[model samples]
Each structure stands twice: as C-alpha cells, then as structure tokens.
Target: LAKTTQPISMDSYEGQEVNITCSHNNIATNDYITWYQQFPSQGPRFIIQGYKTKVTNEVASLFIPADRKSSTLSLPRVSLSDTAVYYCLVVRYNQGGKLIFGQGTELSVKP
Candidate 1:
C-alpha cells in the first residue's frame, strides 16, 4: 500500500479558491488517485479522480503531476457550506479494487 500525506486542516473564505494537496511518495504504476469530500454525518461524496494530468467535474478539479507521486484537489469559489473533510485515496485494482483512505484534510470555509 502506498502511504499518503496531507495537511491536517485548511482555512478559506467565501468565494475563494482552495487547493488541498496530498503526497504519495511510493506510488506504484497501477495506482489511481481519487478524492472524496465528507460532511459531518453524511457519507463521503466523490469529488474527482485521475491517474495523470487533470480531471475536472462540477464539484471540483483534481490535478496529478507527471511523477504520479502527488495530487491536488481544487475547489473553486468556495462557500461556508463547502466546509468539510476531504480525503485523498489511492485505488489499486489488483489489490481487490480496494480504496485506501488517509487522514483527511479538514477545510473550514468562512464567510
């Protein structure tokens, strides 16, 4: 399993763009990068996923460097309601298609 590192917390204001990064130094060739957002009680909601380069959805954008060792999740024009815990996941297909989650980055979106 590839270990991931992320900031413990982050702060952002309303209408601002926020970027939370995660590092995976020992990533393998077959690993895919995924990101999820979790609220206080609700289950994690899928944000985006990418193997390389950039992948964007209506919710957020995910950027993966060419080295494939790190990724960044970008949220544009955030609002107070966007405050949540974001997770960086490493998905390995051969390993029973399991999703390995790490300590998430807590984002506080202020007004």
Candidate 2:
C-alpha cells in the first residue's frame, strides 16, 4: 500500500475557496485517488475519486494532474459547516480492507 501524505492543517474563511493537496509519490499506476472528508465526531467519508482530469459533485471537486503523483480537493465557497479533516488515499480498485490511513489535513473554515 502507498502512503498518502497531507498537511497537519489548513485555514479558510467562510465563502472562500479551499484547496487541499495531497502527495502520493509511491502510488501505483493502477491506483486511484480517493478523497475523503471527516466531521469533528464522525468517521471519515469518501468525497470523490478520480484517475485524471476533474470530477465534481455538489459539494466538492477533485483535480488529478496528468502526472498522477498528487491531487487537489477543491471546496468552492466553503461554509462554516465545511470545516473538517480531509484525507487523500491511493487505493487499488477492489483491494478491500488493504488501505492504510495516515494523519489527515484538518481544515478550519472560519466565519
């Protein structure tokens, strides 16, 4: 399994855009980038997944550069409720229960 690294924390203001980047230098060519977000008292949840280009949802957008060594999770016009810890994971398509979790990035959205 590859290790996904993130910053200890980040800060943003309400209505501001927040971009959190993660690095996966050892990620396999077949691996996919999975972005997860967590609330203050809840388990981390999958936010988005992508191999290249961009994937966007109502809540967030994921950008995977061509090189695939890193990815950025973008939250547009973030609100106070968007404050949470985010994680980026490099995972095999169907290798269940094999992923390892590292310290994630804690994003603080201030009012």
- Listed in order, each prediction's TM-score against the native is 0.96, 0.93
Q: How many pairs collide in each candidate, listed in order?
A: 0, 0
Encode model 2's per-residue lDDT on 1-111: one tens digit a residue.
Answer: 778888999999999999999998888877888888889778888899898899998889999888888899999999999888888888886767355778899999999
> Which residue pairs of candidate 2 clash?
none
Report lDDT (CA) for all predictions.
0.92, 0.87
Candidate 1 local lDDT, 1-111, one digit each (tens): 789999999999999999999999998998899888899989999889899999999988999999999999999999999999999988898779787778799999988
Q: How close is candidate 1 to the true structure, as a TM-score?
A: 0.96
Q: Which consecutive 10 residues in model 1 have the weakest lDDT in total?
A: 94-103
Output the lDDT of residue 97, model 2. Answer: 39
